[model samples]
Target: MIRTLPLLLAVLASPALAQGLTDLDEVDRQVSAFVGQPTPPVDRRLRLARCTAPLALDWYGNGRQAVQVRCPVPAGWTLYVAMPAAAAAAAAPPLVQRGDSVTIQVGGDGWAVSQPGEALEAGAAGAWIKVRGLVPKAPVLRGRVLRPGLVGVDLP
Candidate 1:
């Protein structure tokens, strides 16, 4: 019985056993609050990991076309929820212009790293645009426009 007890504990402590699938309804509510509008329900087919911490929500793609929902680490996952056409059409005008100096940030879990870069193209909020780090020999990268001069990149 003692041997079996250790085996049972191991199974219970496994990462998969530690987390459950995220609730779609909770995701919908959070997304709606982030966008300041009632967002469409999240697809039921998704099987995202349950977040032990509060999910991080952000704008994604050009013109508020989608919302990026992230379940931070220990259960890291990201899902993009598309907005209705009318909402996309109402997005604000371009905020980041080509050749502008910007901050490129790569974030995950509870940490983020940022560096200065130059925008290679103009973009509105949530738009994915090209940017090159100001550091010598840096490669061009694509990131989502978070604001006038802030771009965010997701970990691969």
Candidate 2:
């Protein structure tokens, strides 16, 4: 029994080490409150890597209908939680106008880049829009509108 003690500890710790797990019901409640909308039920059979800390949920690709739940610790994985497909297809109107100065942010791994850009057209939170950077000759980049002046980009 003594010889196997270390092995037992390792086994118990493996799930948390490999990835973090979150309470689906709790997550749904928090997400719903944040968006002011009901979230789709997560399949109970789906297993997620456990997180050591609380999960941070936010709009992932466009910040419109999809929400991303991320582990706060290093090497923790990010899960993309989507809103109902029906609601996504019927999204809302543009939240911003053309020529509007907006904030742009793209994140990957554990780092994010934040900059300012001008909107090339009107778009809603999930709608894609062309954003012109401040640097000279910088090509217009496409990003999703997050809010009034905020946009979120999916990083590779």
Taking all chains together, each candidate's TM-score versus the true structure is 0.47, 0.45
Candidate 2 positional error at 24, Å:
1.5
Model 2 Cα shift for residue 43 (angstroms): 2.2
Q: Write the per-residue lDDT of candidate 2 for residues 26-141, one digit (tens) a residue.
A: 77787777556777766666566666788787765553567777888998877666877545534455788999888888987889899888888888767777888777887877
Least well predicted 10-residue stretch by lDDT in candidate 1? 85-94
Which candidate's lDDT is highest?
A: 1
Predicted structure 2: clash tally: 10
Instruction: Please write out the lDDT profile of model 1 over residues 34-81, one tens digit for every residue.
Output: 877787898887777778888988888657788999887764999999
Pairs of colliding residues, candidate 1:
61-126
In the predicted model 2, the residue pairs found to clash are 19-49, 19-50, 20-49, 20-50, 20-51, 21-49, 21-50, 21-51, 94-123, 94-124
Alpha-carbon lDDT, every model: 0.85, 0.73
Clashes of each: 1, 10
Runs in model 1 with CA error above 4 Å?
1-19, 91-156
